[model samples]
Target: MQTSKVEIEVDTQRIMGTLASPDTGVPGVLFLHGWAGSQERDLQRAREISALGSVCLTFDMRGHAETLSQQRYVTRGDNLNDALAAYDALAAHPSIDPNSIGVIGSSYGGYLAAILTSLRPVRWLALRVPALYRDADWDVPKFSLDRKDLAEYRSSIVSANDNKALDVSRRFRGDVLIVSSENDDLVPHAAIASYRSAFINARSLTSRIISGADHALSTPESQKAYDSLLLGWFREMILGAR
Candidate 1:
């Protein structure tokens, strides 16, 4: 396998990423980092997944890394567009099998990845402690949203029809893997239950909780648990599909 730096143009500005591809054409896996995180966070995991005979991509979403100045101004919609552009760029890679694509997202990235399934052809989806936001603030800067209100909303029961990402999950036909942190305070168990109930049409749904893990998987043991689950799922969902 070989790795190379890549850039994707999104609305005039450019975000950077790394691409890991095998010598032969293979499935593509795109890794989306959490909010406030740069592409570097997912690089090692991407390389590990790529070794499983796949083309993996890890990119910095706008408002992160080189564009940190825009953090306060970047809205969910802008980040969604970044996800779209990254997906397109990955699908277009010469060594990628566009029809067989997988997406792995953490926290904020997981929310965007859920919506991306509705817009693209994704065969496998993996979300780790995915966050949820109300649709009312479509264009509002993410940072400006009331954390108290957001927390209250997440804690309350929400139906699949009432949430955009959950609604998409209802119609998704591919396989899904949802990883919840055992002690995730930011995304409560209710959030995970909400997602679990929304995947009515998925080909398969696998849900697991990382023992004693926090939302960010801050501890090395927690991180190792997540990596193990992810790689095992890829082996079953991505490699097994072949």
Candidate 2:
């Protein structure tokens, strides 16, 4: 496998990443990590996919890694832009097939990936413990806000995330896999339900709930299970016969 460190500039900001390729034209998979996560989390999976004769890209989102130190702004839209740029860069690679691109996102990254399908040509999507996208109050950081203040603020922070995710499912003619932690505490039931309902029009859809797992997959056993589920689904859905 051939690995390369890469940096892509989106507008004035730069997103750092890694690319691993077997120098094959089979397909390309992009890995999007959760909020506060770096590309290191996806490195092993990326290499495994690369060994399987596909190209893979794993990148740190804005307000993350090197980009975090270089910039002060971090928003969902900005992350989406970074993803778009990364997609373009990967697709442009000589060994990659532009039409055969897949994405795997976890938590906050999953939310961005959901929105990205509406904007890009993604053939397959895998979302792991996706964050609550439709609730702005849930996503944003609350430092010193009191209970009463938080409640009032939450009420006013209207979001179209549900609609956006639903639109992607309705519009994107691709395969989808959603892996959720059975004991997750951060994401609400409604949020997960919204994501499940949105896939009504997907060509293919698969879902799994990891037993005794929380949002982080804290235990080694749970972590192994999550990785296996994620990679196995990718093998079937995106890398079929490759």
Candidate whose TM-score is highest: 1
Clashes of 2: 0
Q: In candidate 1, residue 38 scores what lDDT?
A: 83
Q: Which stretches of candidate 1 lie over 4 Å from their true place?
A: none
TM per prediction: 0.98, 0.86
lDDT tens digits by residue: candidate 1, 1-242? 89999999999899998999888748999988889998887988988888888999999999999999999999999999999999999999987887799999999999999999999999999999989889898899988999998888888778998999999989999999999998988999898889989999999999999999998899999999999999999988776877
RMSD of each: 0.8, 4.0
Candidate no. 1 TM-score: 0.98
Per-candidate count of clashing residue pairs (backbone under 3 Å): 0, 0
Looking at model 2, the pairs that clash are: none
- True-structure lDDT of candidate 2: 0.76
Which candidate number has the best lDDT? 1
